[model samples]
Target: MEATFEAFVRARGPALLRYAHLLCGDAGRAEDLVQDALVKVYRRWGPDIAAPSAYTRRAITNEYLSWRRRLTNREVPTQLPEPATRSHTDAIAERDAVWRVLAGLPRRQRVVIVLRYYEALPDREIADLLGLAEGSVRSLAARAFATLRAHPELRDAASVDRASRAEPSP
Candidate 1:
């Protein structure tokens, strides 16, 4: 059990953080969320969990949604920082486009896309973790990708070239 817990932490901790960060868009909050999820996971780790990472990810996702569901008197910013600043390669423009489209999507769609692309999980696993139907996962990803493909901002190849040219040689 000790070895199992340690191995689980070492292997899945980073992945959990990635999912958390994508959902919360705040590093500190993401860490807290993942920690909270890990505690919940610890309490349930006795037996019959065939997929520990999936179980933990569901916990994290549920926590984020629960926190968001709280009716707050305060306003929250919904925008994510540009994924463009993340890269200097020609890929940066396309990647940034993705973020832009991702930002415009509904929260559920955004979460679905992040889990599918970032974790590289299949639809069935995503469904199991998210408590969503497999068909919902497939449609959500498809619609999100279609929206991205149709977004005009992403099609400006010149902008990609511009970003590429702006990079200094390593």
Candidate 2:
């Protein structure tokens, strides 16, 4: 069955927000991005938009790309204000380190990684949303993974993953 925009948002809004946050690296900007994308999606809503989540995700991605373009054309300072934080646990620190690495990647690579790993979408779906060939999507994912694997923080994660995999389930 098809879903309405409001219902979809209500169900999936947090996931969309997380996607945007990963794309842009700021909570405020992510919220704005999601809002802007939803506005566009709401306008374009029709019977043809059978998959609201896919349509919304494409809109969010396009909005982020457009925002980056505008930011590049401006003379604003590159510095961002530091966010307030409480003492972080090891898990939080690990996630933040991963996010730092993700935020460093080029937009296409970042988006490809996020969609493939975080959203768990197939290559064909990612290609369709990004207007990329399926082979291009696979190559992008491979390159991104290579880049991520080279990071020191992720090296630790790789060791942890291996160790966990070697352990039998309780």
Candidate 3:
């Protein structure tokens, strides 16, 4: 079944924000990027965009690129830097750790990881969104995953996951 515009946004909004946050490395900027992309998509909604999710993903990527370009040309920063929020929850800590590692990745690699893992998009779609060959998308994802795997946060997470999956000894 197809999702209505409102339903689509309601269902996918948080995921989109996560993707955007990973791309931009800031929550407020990520919200703005997703909003800008949604406005563009909301304007162009029609039969031509059969897959609204894909359309929105592409819009988000394009908006991020355009915004980054424009930002590079700016002389002064418009907003004051915000401090990172502190939280005591383990889930929150784990998420923050993942975000910290992801923030260190190159833009292309970060986008690839977000789209491939977070959005569950295939290589062909990711390639098309980023205007790269499919092989390039796979290679980028491979490199990104390698980097992620080497990070202590991810390595520890993997170890915990493995331990949880192991059978208890008698």
Q: What is the C-alpha lDDT of each candidate?
A: 0.71, 0.76, 0.72
Which sequence of candidate numbers ranks them by lDDT, best first?
2, 3, 1
Instruction: Please give, for residues 1-170, the per-residue lDDT of candidate 2 as tens digits.
Output: 22666788899999999989778877788999999999888888888898889999999999988888688543222223344356745555666666777677778988887787667787789999999998998788667666666788674676335422332221
In model 3, which range of ten residues has the least summed lDDT? 74-83
Q: Model 1's lDDT to the true fold?
A: 0.71
Q: Write the per-residue lDDT of candidate 1 for residues 11-85, one digit (tens) a residue.
A: 878878878988766777789999998898888886777788778888998888776667373234344444435
**Which ranges in model 1 have alpha carbons more than 4 Å from their true place?**
71-90, 150-152, 157-170
Candidate RMSDs in order: 7.3, 5.7, 7.4
Off by over 4 Å in 2: 1-3, 73-88, 152-170
The top-ranked prediction according to TM-score is: 2
Better of 2 and 3 by lDDT: 2
Report residue 93 deviation for candidate 3 (angstroms). Answer: 6.1
Q: Could you say which candidate leads in lDDT?
A: 2
Q: Estimate each model's TM-score.
A: 0.71, 0.77, 0.67
Instruction: Give candidate 3 regions above 4 Å deviation.
Output: 1-4, 72-97, 149-170
